[model samples]
Target: MPKLRKAQVMILDGILSILMAMTISYVLFAAWPQHRETTGQLALERAGYDIVNAFYEDKEIYQTIRKGFEAKGYLSASEVEYLRTRLYNYGRMLGVSRIDVDIEGSEQFSVEVTHSTPARREQFTLIMPLRGGADDRIIRVSLWE
Candidate 1:
């Protein structure tokens, strides 16, 4: 085979470099959105856990829940409403998009509170048991965008 001319070799090298750059760009563009989505989902999960911990840790919130549990074996409508408001406010302060709370024991109650328009499809749930209860009452906190 004849040796390649310098000009032809340089042209081939330029084309190869261009193709490599395009391939790299395409891979980065394809993977970036997925990485961002995974990060968002992780943040939501952490927010859900924090919300549950906040409820259990705060004296006022803990007392409110305990009062409801002791009084009627379930949360009263007003108590539930208060909790919805309080939780929604707290979640908003933390930049959470939407929150749904579910309490289940002998009865099941649920509340959905939205701080803003729901945009994301991913959801994170935190399940926690109420303390000092003879019944197995579980509180489920769900956070989503």
Candidate 2:
């Protein structure tokens, strides 16, 4: 069964449609799970501006993170519970699985982080196949005295 010669089947169907679109765009932007999410809000605004410039620069962030969260009690540093648990555990190490914050202004206080799924115009389709695009990453932080 060797009767194929229409220019070798149009150059092997254009090289199998460009190697199947580069193997489905490298498995939808590198390995599954409808990912990216605005690079997790630019790594949570660069670790919340280096933790609000290490809490107003130099030192004294609520007495140095309230003496390391009251020596690891996690709460009860005379009040404000270690500055709202360091503004939500530094907004969950920057990935911010989900968050809804509002500090209502102060020496500077405001934050909002919400990301749980590919909701910002979802696009997905993967595994053994070919399509996926996603977005949903919000990070905002402003912490001070």
- On lDDT, the candidate that comes out on top is 1
lDDT of each candidate versus the true structure: 0.66, 0.43
What's the lDDT for candidate 2? Answer: 0.43
* Superposed model 1: Cα runs more than 4 Å off: 1-38, 105-116, 120-131
Candidate 2 is scored at a TM of 0.25
- Indicate which candidate wins on TM-score: 1
Tens-place lDDT per residue, model 2, 50-73, is 555544453444454334334553
lDDT, model 1, position 102: 64
Q: What lDDT tens digits, residue by residue, belong to model 1 across residues 11-94?
A: 999999998887898787753324333577677667766787787787777777778877777777788777777876777766
In order of listing, the candidates' clash counts read 0, 0
